[model samples]
Target: MTFGGLPTRWEPPGASRGVALVAPGRSYPPTAPLLDFTRVALLQHGFTVQQIWWDSLTRGEEEPEAWVRRHVAAAHAREDADRVLVVGKSLGTLAAPYAAERGLDAIWLTPLLTDPSVAEAVGANAGRQLLVGGLADALWDASVARELEEGGCQVLAVPDADHGMGTRGAVRTAEIHLEVARAVEAFLAGAAAGAGA
Candidate 1:
C-alpha cells in the first residue's frame, strides 16, 4: 500500500467517541473477504474503524508512515473523531506507533519485528502503546516486548500463537479479537477519563 492512497473499504459504527484505524498485513487486500469478520467484531464493540488500503501483490511498496498518517487525518476529518486508536496486523503493526505519536493510542497485533530500534524510530516513548502477540511469533522477541513495556506501554502475549494469532486454530479466533477490543476499550476509557479530569 502506498501513502496518500485511500482505504478500499470504510466501516463506520453505530456510535463512537473515537476512531480506530485498521491496517492489514502484506499481500493482503484492503477488501480481503476474511476481514469481514474483523470489521464485524469492531463494529460490534462500537468502534468507528477507518480501513486500510491493503495490496498484497504490490510487494514492497508499502510506505507505512505516510499511509498511517493519511488515514488518520482523513478519518478525523470525515467523522470529527476526537480520539484516535490504531489497530495493525503484521506490517500494519509497524505503522501503529506512528499514529500513537500523533496523539492516538495504539494496538499492534503480531508485528513482524521485535526491534526496539523500530520503536525508537516511531517515537513510542513512555505511554500510549499496546502490543499483542503469540509466543510463537518470531517477529517479536521477549526483549523487544519488554522494551515496549518498560517504555510504559501495555503488552499482551498469547500462548502458542503465531504472527497472525490464527496459526494455532479456531480456539484463538474469538479470544484474540476479544482481547484486542477489551484492551483498546480500556485504554480509550482511561485516556478519556484522564483528559476530562
Candidate 2:
C-alpha cells in the first residue's frame, strides 16, 4: 500500500478494532522479526498493521522524525482511522512526540531514551504506551525507562541485548524476538482494555 506517496506495507485484518503503524529503524527492514512480531501481535489483538517501507528515510542523511510525522499523518488521513497504535524501533522512536501529541497508543522497541525529546514525549504522553530497551544498548537509559514507567508507560528491559535487542547469535536472537513478541501481545491487550476506561 501507499500512504502520501510513500511505499508502505499493510497487514489489515478483518473486524480490526484498531490500527497499528510500525516505523522501523534505518537499518532494520519492516520484515525484521521484531517488527514482524509486532505485526503478528497486533493481528492477534484485532489491530491492523500499517508499515512504512524504506525509501529516502533509510539513508539517514536527514533526520527521520519529520518524515515519520508526515507519513503518520498521511496514513491516518488515508485510513480515516480513529484508534491508532504507533510502534517504532531505534531511529523510529523519534516518532514518540507525534504519537504523544496525537494521543495514540504506542510501542517503542529499543528506543533512543538518551534523547531528551524522546524522554519528554514518553513522560508527557497521556495515551497507553509500551517502552522496551536493553541495558547493553548505549541508547537505552535505565533511569529514563524507570521514569516513563513511573509516568504510566509499560516498560521492558532486556539484559545483554543491543540496539536491535539481539542477544548475540541467531539462536539467542530468535529467543529474544519471541520474548519481545509475547510482551508486545500482552501490552497491546492491556492498551486495548485501557482504551475503554
lDDT of 2 by residue, 1-197 (tens): 67567545555567878788888887886778888878877887888788876565355655667877776677677675678888888877888999888888889999999999889998888888889878899999999899889889888898878888987699988887787887898897787676678
Candidate 2 runs further than 4 Å off: 2-13, 56-62
Error of 1 at 63 (Å): 5.8
**Top candidate by lDDT:** 2
lDDT of each: 0.61, 0.82
Tens digit of per-residue lDDT, candidate 1, span 1-197? 24456434445555665666777777554444234455555565556767766444444564665655555456556656666666677766666546655656666667655555456643454437667777777886767777767767777776676666655457666677567556655655666566668
Worst 10 residues of 2 by lDDT: 3-12
Q: What TM-score number comes out for model 1? A: 0.69
How much is 156 displaced in model 2, in angstroms?
Answer: 0.5
